[model samples]
Target: MLIRILFFLAFLFLIDWYSFQAFKASFPGNFWVKLAFWSFSIIVYLFVAYTFLTFSNRGVSSPNFGRMASLLILSIIPKLIILTFLFGEDILRVSTGAFQSIAGSREGDFLPDRRKFLNQTALALAAIPFVGILHGVLIGKYRYRVIRHTLEFDDLPEEFDGFTITQISDIHSGSFDDRKKLEYGVDLINQQGSDVILFTGDLVNNRSEEMEPWIETFKKLHAPLGKYSILGNHDYGDYMSWPSQEAKAANLQHLFQIQEELGFKLLRNESVQIQKGNSSIDLIGVENWGKGFAQYGDLAKAAANLTKESFKILMSHDPSHFDEEVKSFAHHIHLTLSGHTHGMQFGIEIPGFIKWSPASLRYPKWAGLYEELGRYLHVNRGFGFLAFPGRVGIWPEITVLELRRK
Candidate 1:
C-alpha cells in the first residue's frame, strides 16, 4: 500500500513539474506566477500524500475518500491535458537537442527555446476541463436529465402498450450529502408520472444503513402501478469488511427490509407478472450477475414456468450479464434494463453527433439504449455519482421508457 502511494505521488510530481514548464514558457520570468504555481502544486501533492497515507478500510461508505478522489480528479485531469501538449513539446526539444549536440553545441544548451504560442495553446485547452470539473463538482452532479424513450415490439401486450416506466439506477445513497439536491432529484422522478418505477440497483455504496438518511426522500417517488428494485453489486456489501458472516448476512437482510419500507418490491432472482386487462407480462429480476462481478443470480430459477413466447423484461444490474448470458438464453428476454457502468462518470455525449466515454472501451453498452437480435437493452447512466463524487458531462439520469406495440 505504501509503495503504491509513493508511486502515485511520484507520478503526480512528474505531472506537476512537467506542467510547470508550460507555466514558465507562457509567463517567462514572472516570479509571482511561478511561486503561485509551485505553491498550489506542493499543497495538492502534500494533501494527496496525506490522504493515501491515512487511508483506511472505510471503503465506499466514507465521504472523505470520495472528496479526496474528486480533488485528485479536478487537479490531475487538466494537468494531464496540459502534459499531452507538453509531452509533444518535449519530443521536439529532445530531437533538437540531439541534432544540436551532433553539431558540437554544448549538451545542456542544445534544446531550442520554448514556443510561447504552443504553451499558451495547451494552457488554454487545459483550462476547459479545469473549469468544467469545478462546475461538475458544484452543479453538474445534481443536474438531472429525464430521458424518454419508446421501444416498439410486435409481441408487446396490447394493454401494456404505451405503458410508461421510469428507471433509475446506482443511487449510492452513502455518497449523497446534500438533502435538498437529493430531494429535488426524487421530486423530478415523481414529476415524470410514469406508470411504474423500476430501480436497477446500487441503493447504497457499501453498507445497508447508508440508506437510512435518504429513505424518506426516496420514498416520495410515486408510481401509479408500483415501484420495483433489484440488487446491484454494491448492495451486497461485498466491498467492505464485516465482523462475521452473520453480520454481512444481517446487513443484506436489513437492506431488503429498508427497500420494503420504501415500497420497492425488492426482487432477488425472482419473477413477477404485471397484469393489465386479460394479458400479463413477466418482469424477471436477478441478483447482481455480471462477467466480472458477483454471480448470485439464478436466471433459470427466475424464469421458471415462464414460456419463451411470453414477452419478458429483465432487470439485471450489470450490462455485461446482458451481453454474456442474457442474450443467448433459451427463453428469450425481449428487453433488459441495467446500470452498473456509470459512464465512468465522465464523457462527451451529444444526442446524434457523438456519444463517447472511457467506459465504452470496457463496456460497449455503457449507457443509453441498444438493440441486439431484436432485443432491447437500456443502460441508465445512473441516478447518482460514485467514487469521484461528481459527474462531468454525463449528468444524473432519470429514464422514462414507454412500450409501443408494433
Candidate 2:
C-alpha cells in the first residue's frame, strides 16, 4: 500500500514538472511570471495529491469522493498530452545541440532556448482534450442518445415479427450526481415505446444501497410486454471487502430484492417464454460472465427447456460471453444483448463513417452490432459512467432494437 501511494504521488509530481516545463517555455525570461506559474502548479498538485491520500484512506464507499478522485485523474490527461509534444521539442533541441558540438560549433551557436511557436502549439493542442473532458463531465455524461437498429431474421416468428426491444445497461447508479438528469434519461427510455425492456446489468457499483435513491425513478420505466434483467460483475459485490462471507451474501440478496422492487424480473441462468398470439420466442438470461471476471452464467441450463427451433434472445452482461460460448452452443442463440464494455466509457463514434474505442482492442465486440454465423450480438454503450466519473466521445446510450422477419 505504501509503495502504491508513493508511485501515485510520483506520477502526479512528474505531471506537474512536465506542465511547468511547458509553461516556462511559453513565458521565458520572466522570473516573477515563472515563480507565479510554479506556485500555482505546485498548489494544484499538492491539493490533488492530498485528496488522493484522503480518499485512499477513507475508502471508495462514498460516491462524492470517488467522483472527486476520478476528476483529479482526468485533470492530468491534458497536461500529459501537452507534455508529450513539449518533450518531443526538447529532444529535438538536445539532438541539434549534440550534433552541432560534435561538428565543432560553440555552445552560443547551438539551438536556441525554446521556440515560442512550439510551446504555443503544444498548449493549443492540449486545449482540445481539456475542453473535451470538461464537456464530458458537465454535459456528455447525461447526454443520453437513443440508438435504433433494425435486425432481420429468417426464422423470426410471424406474430412477433415487428417486435421491439429497448436495452439499457451498466446503470452504475453510485456515480450519478444529478437526479433531474437521471429522470430525463428515464423519460427518454419510456419515450421509445419498446414492446419489452431488457437491462443488462451493473445497476450499482459495489453495494445495493447505491440504488436506493433511484429505485422510484427507474420504476417509472414501462413496457407493454415486460422488463427483464440479469446481473453484471459489479452487482456481485465482489469489488468491496465484507466483514464476513454472510455479509456479502446478504448484500447480494438485497440487490436481488432491489431489482424485484423495481419491477425487473431478475433472471439467473433462466429462460422465460414471451408469447404473442400463437407465436412465442424464448428469452434466456444468465448471470454475469466475462473472460477474466466471474463466470456465474450457465448457458446450457438457461436454454435447457428450449428446442433447437426456438428463437432465442439472450441477455448476458458481458459481450465476451457471446464470443467465448453462446455462438458455439448446441441451440442457435439468434440474438445476444450485452453491455459490460461501456465502450470503455470513452471513444469516437460517427454514425457509419467511423466507430472506434480502446475497449474494442480488449473485447472485440465492444459496442453496437456484431454478427457471426447468423448469430447477432448488440453491445450497449452503457447508461452510466463509472470510475472515470464522466464520459468523453462515448455518450450514455439507450438502444432500441426493432426485430423484423426476413
Candidate 3:
C-alpha cells in the first residue's frame, strides 16, 4: 500500500512537471507565465489540502466517514491532475506539430509560426481535460446503470432451445456498501421471467457473511427447473485474513448453505441431467478452474456419469478454464459459461479494436461470447465489481441465454 501511494505521488509529479513545461513553451517563458504557473500551483495545493481536511471528517454521525471521505478524495485527485496536464500538453503538441510542418515547407517566417505552434500545443493539451471530463461522466453513468437483456442462441438443442436461463455472475455482494442499492439489483434480477437461473460465481467478495443480506433476496429468483451456482475465486475466502483454517472451511460450507438458501443447486465438479419432455441435456458445474487460480476444477469428474452423446452446457467460473482444459476433457461439453473477469469493470466493444477490461491481459476471453478450438464459451462481464466499486464501460449484466438448436 505504501509503495502504491509513492508510485501515485511520482505519477502526479511527472504530470505536473510536463504541464509546467508545456505552459512555459507556450507563453515565451516570461514573468507573467511564471507567475501564473506558481499561482495555479499554490491554489491547487490549497484546494487539495482543503479537500483532505473536509474528507478527514466525512459525516457528522458515520463512524467510518473519515476513511470513506479520504478514499473518495484520493480517487478523484489523480483524474483532476491528469486532466490539467493533458489540457496543457494538447495545446503544446498541436501547435508545435503544426508550426514544424509549416516551417519545413518554408512557406512563412519561423518565429511567429513557432509561437503559434506552442499555443496550439497548449490548446491541444487543454482539450485532454475536457475529454477526460466527458469520459468520466459517460463512464460514471454507464458503468453503474443496471442493464437487463435476453439473448437467444440458435445452436441450443431443441428441447432446451427456448429455455430462458437467466445468469448473474461476480455479484461481489460484499462490495455493496449500501443495502438499498443491493436490494434494488436483486429485485431487478428477480423480475426476469427466467425458467432457470445460473449464478456463475464470486457471489461474495471474500467473506461468506458478506452475502448475508443478499441470500434471501436472491432466493426470490425462482424457476420451474431450478437455480444453480458454482464457485468463483472470492467465494473461497482467499483474499482476506480469516481467524483459522476451520473458520475458512466453515465459511465455504456456510456459502454452500447460502446457495441452498438462495434456492440454487450448488454444483461443485458435478453434473445433473435436466429433462425437458422426452429429451435432456447435461448441466455441468465445476469448481474454480482457471490459470493461476484454483486448479481443482475437474471436468472429467464433473462429466463422469454424463454421456458424450448428449448435449452438454457447463458452468465454470473462469473463462480461461475452457482455454486450458475444457476441449480435451471430453466432447460432451458444447457450451461453457463463465464470469470471473467482470471485463475489468471497463472496456470498449468497438469493431477491430474490441479493447476488453484490464482482466483481458490475464485472461484473453474477458467478456461476451467467444469460441475456441471448436468449443463455445460465453464470458459474462459480471454483475458487480471488486476494489474500484465502479463499473465504468462495463455495466452489471443479467444474461438471458435462450438455448437453441443448430
Best by lDDT: 1
Worst 10 residues of 3 by lDDT: 57-66
Clash number for every model?
0, 0, 23
* Model 1 local distance difference test score: 0.90
lDDT value for model 2: 0.88
Q: Where's the lowest-lDDT run of ten residues in candidate 1?
A: 52-61
Structure candidate 2, residue pairs in collision: none
lDDT by residue for model 3 over 14-125, one digit each (tens)?
Answer: 6556556555666664888789666655555444445434542112112233223334433344445544555655676577767877668454533233344644455575
Candidate 3 local lDDT, residue 158: 75
Error in Å for residue 235 of model 2: 0.6
Tens-place lDDT digits, model 1, residues 325-357: 898999989999999898988999998899999
Against the true structure, candidate 3 reaches a TM-score of 0.73
Per-candidate Cα lDDT values, in order, are: 0.90, 0.88, 0.69
